[model samples]
Target chain A: MPVSIIRPIDIWFAEQIFPHEQRFHAAALRISGSRDEAEELVQEAFARLFELEGWAAIEDPRAYVVRMLRHIAIERLRRRRIVDFRQFADTDHLTLADDAPDQHRIAAGRERLRRASDLIAKLPERCRTVFVRRRIQGESSQEIARDLGISQSTYEKRLARAVELLSRSWQGDEDALPAAAGPANTSRRSGSR
Target chain B: MSIFNEKQRRKRRIAREAATWLARHDSGTIDEERFHAWRGATPEHAIAFARALAVWREAQSKADADTYHLLQSRFTRRRAAAAIGGMGMAGLLTAGAFTSRAYAWDSSHSGVGECKRLILPDGSRAMLNTDSEMQWRFSDDERSLWIVRGEVGLELVRGIPARIHGLDRMASLSHGRFNVRLEGAAMDVTVLSGKASAAPVSAPVVMPGQPALIPIVIASPSEGLLLSAVAPSVRKASPQHLAATIAWQQGEIVFDNEPLQTAVREYNRYLAGKIVIADPDLTGIPVGGRFTSTDPADFLSALELGLGVRATPSNGGYVLTR
Candidate 1:
């Protein structure tokens, strides 16, 4: 049987780096304009950052990591330019494109986002952790449960509760514009495949 | 409560349902056709789902920005302290050591009857099959890893060369995905994406200054198998076989008219109880299916119905007879 040792670095990464994964992923998605490429870029950035001797010394790890991802994305885009323009054109289908929104829409979206954040912040401690780990960090339920010292079913329940609470908080809002930006539903599925 | 409150509660309930459906869809456990039907069941359901999705996306991006700002502020404070050059550097260095101690060799393993996917520190990925153990070590110059036991499917990042140590062979891969299964003293290396070269662990080290274009041996090495003496073994694997071999990554075992014994052995790797074919003749019977590795009930039922075999619970595991 293999030994199961929980290393301190694992704990540190779980605490510091893992929590910001959603932000890093979002930034990559904005820059790369493809979920697959974004995921890859983020992973690469993490790998590179983890290898750095002074990773813990970095002032803002999330910003540093996101910046590294942006650099990598730019480099990748440059290389792909030489190989094929068609592949670059396909990136326009990204749900989280980096295009500038109208001032009115930006202001409205920011208000909605702030409200959503407030709702998330009001969630029970365990529920909030579960939600952030599962939805934001992109961790598996099993992994989150193992880390939280809970059963997978319990983790799922907490996540469901968190989602329910957030949905309830945003339910009566009149500014929920219909999803008009991109093919949000099918994009993730196709990207994974 | 007021009628307005009641209406708000109803809207919340609908939003909750939509959130649940979205989660189910994302988890890959829901049927797409059924999900589409549910979405189209009523106008309210469709609108609620759209709103839920929008909220989800908005919250995700907002969380990212919030986290970024929070970290930025925290870092600014630390930077101020470091600029003063009083105990900050030492403290940060000590903390860094503690944080990065795990990066030396991130060892991971899959227990018996379990499969696992690992995202390594260096933008590489590894999927371990049942009862597998692997270690990842990345440095400034190179990314190195070793599969100590069982099997692993690896996807290496572009422009980075990796040196992999399997059971009895070492493989040098440059920007590709590959599956390596170690059985006894021999190993099978199948390149799923780019290029890889393998050599016996006992082979003399060949260090050519330039990029070595080795000849890869796809076949498992036998006692008298003559590999090209000078050229290192490198080859592009067939896509079909690569997919079939790596199907375990998706929690499946695909058998293409494989022997009953072989199929049973593969199943046994991912199951608690072994399936023993009592009759030697029955062992050679061909079986084919795409089976979920954890459950053997379907395979057993198919054997009973199609092959007319009887499976009985034995003290050790299960005994199959015809």
Candidate 2:
């Protein structure tokens, strides 16, 4: 059975760091001048943020993230042995002012709730059923498996697929979405044709 | 490039593993020690788990019965279409669906003293302030919204950028939250998050094989643009002003040293019975504070106590005089 021990840092990262992702990406794009580099910069900054001993003490995680992104960008440029002064100069305005956390969270939550159904609607049939039953319907896995006449492992696989697709799409990976299809559909086997 | 691809593949795999663990955990079948070890193995794993958790939480939220039924119908419709395949009936059905959806515009309105929250067809959230009228039309390629009157608070999801129409002015918002209000001959777009560009409605459309040139005024968080066909200007809003601008979302009208007339005008938008300045001399008096938008009793009392302005009962509203 799963032990439900929630970590403080996990909650902090989810609530504080993850919500302001657009700002971080915009900042990274401005500094890096390429989408790939910006992705790397943001990722590296996040990894480094996870490692920070004083992450819990950060008053403004949003601004701290920008600072981390800036530092990562500068470090990469320095290591390259050739820095673009103009690019370096443009990183000055990266630090963002903190908005009221409650307002931000409320707004973000509303957006997520609004989008969740649409995302769920787009899921392939089998996965959608398993996901909706398990998540939205709040049915136990054993109950869902029994009702659907599927094994627990099959239920897990379908749920995982749904989650993976949603995770990618929710994170703004739109252009490269794998064409969704039912498990038994031969068209899906031929790849996104 | 190969290294990047390898890293991307690794990330995807990690995310998949995270999803599996989440599913297992939710099922009450996850092995505690193994799941903990997997999550703590690397920072990436933890981040992936958090990302999945966020989505999981949202999807697992208790939805109204109407929403569940709507989702079920949508799912069934899609499945029916898929099952029909490349038949004449399918073609006709698809065409009928397109015709009905393509030209149909969904509209929402909030009457005086009432605020309404709406979830648009495309999964964007729009909260209409009192006396507001908004209409939206969505398609595969475009998500268009028209703010006919008053104010709207929008939290748009990432997808096709939404084009907001106002009085001879428009703004294209690429997924973000904003408070858009229609004022006299202009639209005030306040960016709470995300990026939006304001331009005139008459801006040239991009034609194939030709370069397009349109002046774009982009607004960021805590920034606003006064979008008018004649002149579009961007301004930064102080935190206090920003707070005041959006306080209407909470059914409160906040005035930060705003002129008495202006404050009354703003408050009148939410009241069935309006507040009027009977004494012209009281128009320019600076007013400050937060008051319930739907009621004017507290506001009137504050004015009487602080500014010594007396409010007398008028026809259906209150008339303030010095």
Candidate 3:
């Protein structure tokens, strides 16, 4: 519960490293040819970034992440004693990719924000109440718990449930929830009537 | 499968813990040292916490009052089912007074040289270009947008195709991305990835020696349709052309072998201080390059360097001459 003062590293990672996640995942997929391996490669690159001391001095974070992913993939292949040099041959252009936010990326960001709303709506009724009040409406926990005639712990639990489901859903987890909410998984997007 | 399930469970546990920490931080009841220790425990922990923070920050800023009201209105069980049914029945359930009014009709206007992005109630996204005005109305069975002026880029969600009304004509836009501009009674629609069929708002009165208004369907990303009562034409747009069309979204104007007058006029859309060609002869000269839309300094410099032209400050604008 780091309150009041945020770590400088967290800010750098969230701003510089996190925004380019889709690209990193895509690149990792191209190298690994498996979703699970791609996820692991991206996570390992992020972990290495956390341990880096010169992280702040990097001018282009997207390219830095791409290079890191390539290194991590190479390391994994070495450990497994099977390396596909061809897979990594044409990837030099990726490190030189433009870091500017393009029109498609801008649209994707808007879609992400909208998807957040849709995910919140799909939450269970109890969890949705706490989430809408605390997260979206910016109501204090105490105020929401009191207004809803619930105990403080109950409010926290409901909120935590909402957050867990939403986090999984946002990360594209198909089994994030059960049929109690509806189908276990909907498409990437479910239109609101 | 069991191993995968185990991994999933561990991931879920980390996510839940991170969320709890974030909540505690928000409520001002966190132990800072313990929070740092937990985050430093593993790479997955740090990643989980970062994801939670991203969601928290986005909801804190992007989910504005309108979205909040919409969420509250659809808070009930039956209404939630209706929303999921995707049958456009949620609006008919008397969702809420503020909810219906807020979602049924909304309008926004962007100032000159300023662009704005909006998330409509039906989850559709619209970006208003400089000096643009638009309004949206969503009912139980229909979704429509009215571009009163200027340009708008639309990304319609998958459900009901949206009806676009501009000037005296209209277009039916299905799920896709489109750039639509209203220029003096004409609607220019460039479909980036969608389907659009343009027609007049009313039945055309066929008269002697007058061509009847024909409907045009633009189905490919390489097509742009100009919809007007007088003359409606479909033009093939290359990939480069499409990129140039939406370059304004990135605060850029691209000129590919375009006349100097045409480029100047396009750039003028995003500038407060207009650029005037004092020499009429230079107007027809072809110019090609990309320049920032909001500034004319680089553009003028390019003109000066490319051709034997000079710019002089005149009446809060720039006058160019050979």
**Candidate DockQ scores, in order:** 0.08, 0.17, 0.13
Error of 2 at A154 (Å): 0.6
| lDDT digits (tens) for residues B1-322 of candidate 2 | 7886797678789878988988888777788799889878988888888777766755644242224333332122223323333343422332232232335688989999899999988888999999889989988998989898988999999998898876546788979889998775557788877888875555567686876577668887767776753446677654345657777877777764556877888888888788889889999775655567888887887787667899998888999998
User: Candidate 2, after superposition: displacement of residue A98 in Å?
Assistant: 9.5
Worst 10 residues of 3 chain B by lDDT: B72-81
Q: Which CAPRI quality tier does the interface of model 2 achieve?
A: incorrect
Interface Cα root-mean-square deviation for all models: 22.7, 10.1, 10.8
User: Model 3: per-residue lDDT, tens digit, A61-113?
Assistant: 78888888888887777787666777667455556553443323334444556
Task: Please provide, for model 1 over B81-160, each residue's C-alpha lDDT reduced to its tens digit, 9 standing for 90 to 100.
Answer: 23443433333332332233345677999987798888877777888999999987887786878778888888878756
Q: Against the true structure, what is each candidate's TM-score?
A: 0.40, 0.46, 0.48
- Fnat per candidate, as a fraction, reads 0.18, 0.44, 0.31
Better of 1 and 3 by TM-score: 3
Give the TM-score, chain B only, in order for the candidates: 0.60, 0.67, 0.63
Candidate 2: where are CA atoms >4 Å away?
A1-5, A96-108, A175-193, B61-322
Best by TM-score: 3
The TM-score of the first chain in every model comes to 0.42, 0.79, 0.78
Candidate with the larger TM-score of 2 and 3: 3
